[model samples]
Target: MSKYLLNKFLFTVDRDPELVERYRAEPRATVEWWESARANRILGCHADESSTWLCFEDAEREALAAHDYPRLFELGAHPFLTLTLFIAMFERDHPPLGFQTEYARRLAHVRLPYPDIAT
Candidate 1:
């Protein structure tokens, strides 16, 4: 799986407030649209500079589309990026610290030997 691409998606989406809201509200559509329109567009560069080789694997796509952060972690997405973006999307739905606690609880089954995150 392309961990770099996955992290790139998280990092990019997390940085843009509008995209963040879009992703939070319509994850599948956001992921599909991003894969089609933004995946290969080099950040801060002109559209002509876009690359042609970046795409999410099916698992990665589905995980992201489902807002399955735990699946993302298992698929080697960076934890910080995942957590930060997820917090932005979901924290408001809970009481203070409740989302974080839920996040931890959801990941409690993960063992020490986490999946390799290196791209």
Candidate 2:
């Protein structure tokens, strides 16, 4: 719902199908890898024990499990890649109920049918 630059995490996941699959297959390992990369300065993330970073990581996990795309966006997920993130997570076994559940969750926060939509 905001005009923001491409989100590093979602952008990366969007571009790399392999990475998306990896996250689908190994959420814990993927998070662990990110933590290692950030801690070792492999990624641009600062090597600090910042509570914000930890919170984001935890939020990411929760978002994935709950199929709460808006939650990810609130935690700095890319708006453009929001749908893609949902698709990636549920690609293997698409369940109607699961999709509906996620859709309802997102719909609750959606502002009308226009400008409030995430850019």
Candidate 3:
């Protein structure tokens, strides 16, 4: 599932204003571009030091491209990272707490023994 890479995508995109906008506006394209261009680039390291592996699985890619937060949670993406990035992208469209409420509601079906988040 590459939870680490998924979390990395959330974390990285959340921290950058432009990228956040880009992701919100062009999810599929952004996911594709990120996977192709940045997924293997080690953070805080030279480009040449990039890792050779770190691609999202097909389901993971689809979940991200679709902004399916509930699916992301099922895939073991870190909740905080997902929420933070999601809030940034969607909170503005709702009244205060509305998006959060919706987020929780959408994930209400998740039961105990949550998916393992450890990378």
Candidate 3 regions with alpha-carbon error over 4 angstroms: none
- The reply for model 1, stretches above 4 Å from the true place, is none
Task: Give the candidates in order of lDDT, highest first.
Answer: 1, 3, 2
Which segments of model 2 are wrong by more than 4 Å?
1-6, 38-68, 95-101, 104-107, 110-119
Worst 10 residues of 3 by lDDT: 1-10
Instruction: Decide which is better by lDDT, 2 or 3.
Output: 3
Question: CA lDDT of each candidate?
Answer: 0.97, 0.54, 0.95
Clashes of 1: 0
Please give, for residues 1-104, the per-residue lDDT of candidate 2 as tens digits: 22222244555666777877886777667756644453233244455633233223455655644545666656555555766665766744656567646656
Per-residue error (Å), model 1, residue 18:
0.4
List, residue by residue over 1-119, the lDDT tens digit for candidate 3. Answer: 58999999999899999999999999999999999999999999999999998899999999999999999999999999999999999999999999999999999999999989998
TM-score of each model, in listed order = 0.98, 0.51, 0.97
Clashing pairs in 3: none
